[model samples]
Target: MTETAEQAVQFVAMARKSFPALSSMRGSGGPAAAAVRSAAPMASHFLRRRGEDLLMKAVQVETEAGLANVREIAKVEGLDMVFFAPVELAASAPRGQEAGLLLALETAEAEVKRAKKLLGGMLVPGRSAEMMFAAGYDLVCTTSDVILVRAAAENIVREAKPPATGPKGGLVRFVTSGREAKFARNDETLVTRLKKSRQARALGALVRLGSAAAAELVAASGFEVVVLDHSRGAEDLLGAVALVHAASRAGAHSLMRVPALSQAHLRRALQVGVEGIILPGVESAEEAHALVELCLYPSRNLRDDSHAAEARLKNQPFRRMDFSFAPPLVEFYGQRVAEFSRRQGEALLIAAQVDSPEGAAHIREIVKVEGIDMIFVDAMRLSGADVERIETAAKKHHRLLGGLLVPGCHVEDMYRAGYKLVCAASDHGLLAEGAKACLKAERPVE
Candidate 1:
């Protein structure tokens, strides 16, 4: 089997453990779903190959004759039949995006049902994941890798930390800063939006597992930001690029939570289009300052400006979809990129995770460091008093505060306690809870 086929097998093995009765799970044959979260360059590749490869290969190859041959081979090989629809053909279609998708869905559904094979809709768009499952898709693979790893990482962190007291362990009211209020009225960033409208309390989904398709789906749900948690999830440079691109395509801002304060991690994340980076385990003002420097270009130190720096600095400007310039304006764009690079520390947000007592003690000083956008405390790592100290320091420094809100922790209380950014839940948490609810409702004890 090909490497892609092997991944499908792994997915099948993983799925069977959850639903023993499931006979088999198939992989998506189309490139879009196959490539959605696969790597960063996949989208550009697909776009460039629109005329020949996408149409001829995807649409034509997934025909009845081709599928029948595959079905026979699968039976001979003792494998289950998995049908892939030509969803990628939607982009190459003569019709518009929506019309292409509707046509492909109708055609693929019929073909897969006729052959008695499991329909595999790779990279289901928008809220179509829910609808596909409801339409009786045996198994739907929304995303994989980083998302799952992050879920496990978060669970481990939660388990290792101190448990909360009774529900609503510490309650405090949160107020937006004057600067935040001003930004809300002017900037399009997630922070600004949340501040502008109290009712616009933005909810974000953390992609712990490296599923760009899943991230895209979450983005479709109207989240202001989608966080790719590298601190707890299994992700490398390529995976981060894919997740960030996918989130942006789905109209959501992307944030990456790095494991530590490192230049390599920060530089790569910025290059790949993350709007912000969350630095976990920040314990001192010096460390916080260093983290900010890592994210910024042209720090106080003297360094030669190389051709590579120019190219990478230009990467940020290319992030905007409509960023086009005239041939004569090339020099102007270059100057803009150069200036943007110097002041990037001010433009890009820096978030620090304070999960240790040492970090809590230095919270005031850490917040004083410029570019430290928000401070998130792990509820398990800090007690009521510890939280109070952090809150007091935040007020003094005039910085925004944030935290992780697990179950039984009252959201209102956290807000009252002055948490501007509270990650109430994650993708894996929601999935597990939803599954348990389904099982409980359908399979009650006698």
Candidate 2:
């Protein structure tokens, strides 16, 4: 059996084995026979992604501990910038310099808005910068900034000591059990959108998660996407699974940038409830076609004949998929996987990363591959002409285009350049940027 065929036998064995204790008991809604103060009147509006409206969070005062508190805020993990807001000048145009105030405000506001319109990577854990990137970026009127600063001020104190006892405890309790990531807590996966609106492009902020806390934080930060950066390989499979659970519970969509395209990696990525996979380093049309087959099972309306592939996969032996789990559990998982793969194209986002000219040269063929929903290109690679050629091909084939939110580029610029998806820098980059901002914010103003 080929690797994919061999692994197919384990599909049903791949049903996530976690979180059955409480999950097996579905809530038909109430906490009991009575309505309580803790219950809301409506279903939660939390979604797989946030809307297109721009968001800005401002840090007004760190009055708790003076410069020490200020420095504390600066060191937060993903905090990106310490924008020097010249409130005195932007607000108080002295009688003689009223006209000049307009110029000062324009220059200051422009300088204050951070670069790249971060994809919700603004606040990690540190205080290097007073403010973190929220979502959309635009010119805020002086009055609006002041109002926004005040609104965000409440969160500075509130998030300082958020409710600690909920999902964090849930992580410890269920993370080891291998919970099913799809339809977590009864919240539908983003895959449902395939059935509803295939033409709706993926838009809005995406935060890469490294921990359960990060997952909750990203979701609460209002980002629509919670991403796991598995480009380092599958060394952290358990950790990635935990993030998926946390992201699902916290109400965000999870996707992964995988290191390779092996059947084991792709199968596990899906079984774990990742909504999408961005596979890196593709150089040929055959590789792209293989990616589709490995990812999309055998859809008759889509890629290949489903019945034959199913039979081949079912009869194959895949020790890789059925390692040390109990026999009964493995049997159950295989069944679930078989069921999932049949309809996975509706939920899974398959992307190909074309970084070299070899891949770019085959852009038309790659974009024509049936199962891929998106194609990601490394902006730092390829000449401008190559990028444009890929862009044209991708659009012509009706594929969504994605790219790096590289420095010297804004999120809007990527959108204008015909990219529907734009990824920001990694958490490491955000952390380092935040750390620098902390130092800059702490320096005594001259």
Candidate 3:
């Protein structure tokens, strides 16, 4: 046999030696004597009489049938088996099977205990690693290929992206004393600033260009706000957090357009501390109210002090500052929850899109909804008359009018039409256009 295989066999033999055969247990004294007596039944569950050869094998399972087979083998041998059932397998198993397999493993674990045999459960990396450890298994398996690859990828991404530093969230105009310092920006928060600044005409950037580097570069380019566009592209919570932090560290305000009006997406965006959320395709006052409720909380109508928001703080990237949000082994997360809650729509901008005819039709009612701060018209989708109606409604309700202004749409016309926060071009649009221009320049026409 190869050296590694020889070592594995030697190790298995050593393990087997610890539990003496049932016939010899009476002679083995001390703690082991008692252990052997209790563990003898376990030996029978694993070993089978195959003429002259004995097989020592471990069960590595991801399915119910596989686990059941191991359980049956252990039962037949009367010696407990040290089975390896990875947590990832249990989690990815069919919905009901995931729970069922875990329970079955737990049941097999109990049988092992009864027979005084060995049972060690293996677990993969994820939120479940801690859960399985806390479940009181005898041996906790180390990281496997899944975890190694995940960790490696995360490390590479972190290395490629710049770490967040300095002040985070909102704008800060620092003032200094002889030894100490304090400062303030506009009394209006980012949302309020965008809402009330009619003549501000602050240059803003639409950050559809993903990656932490892109976000950081855009934030440093002197934009008043970085609107993270997820409506047209793919974005995850972690990426959004990175963008938000990068924007904040670069002294720019952060906003996000969620994939949709999803509670999970809204909560994650809020927890990551986006200064605003632009809800797309809002059609009615009721939908506006619901969106607003999801955006704001501690209000009379809606609240979510759930762990979903608080748990994001558990990760370092989502922490409020350099200091930890979670206290050392304490259950009181109220303070942390309150910290997240304070960033709600009232404190941040709650803008909605009047993109379709249905949405434009209810502009007046939608604008009147409490907590709705900005009404953005999708210039591409809405007609000139429709844009006019939305603009009129926004003006009447004293809400900010904002939208995406394409090439043909005059920026001055948008401003004249009372659109305060206008995105003339997005990161993707700029890059695509620049590439096309470069190609045309390279092959000049005669």
lDDT of 3: 0.61
What's the candidate order when arranged by decreasing lDDT?
A: 3, 1, 2
TM-score of each: 0.49, 0.50, 0.52
**lDDT winner among the candidates?**
3
TM-score of 2: 0.50
Q: Model 2 off-target regions past 4 Å?
A: 1-209, 233-235, 297-338
Query: Which 10-residue window in model 3 sums to the lowest lDDT?
Result: 322-331
- Per-residue lDDT of 323-348 in model 1, one digit per residue for the tens? 11111111112233334443343345
Angstrom error at residue 199, model 2: 8.3
Q: All models: lDDT?
A: 0.57, 0.51, 0.61
* Candidate 3 lDDT score at position 55: 43
> How many residue pairs clash in each candidate at the backbone level?
13, 28, 10
In what order do the candidates fall by TM-score, top score first?
Answer: 3, 2, 1
Which candidate gets the maximum TM-score versus the true structure? 3
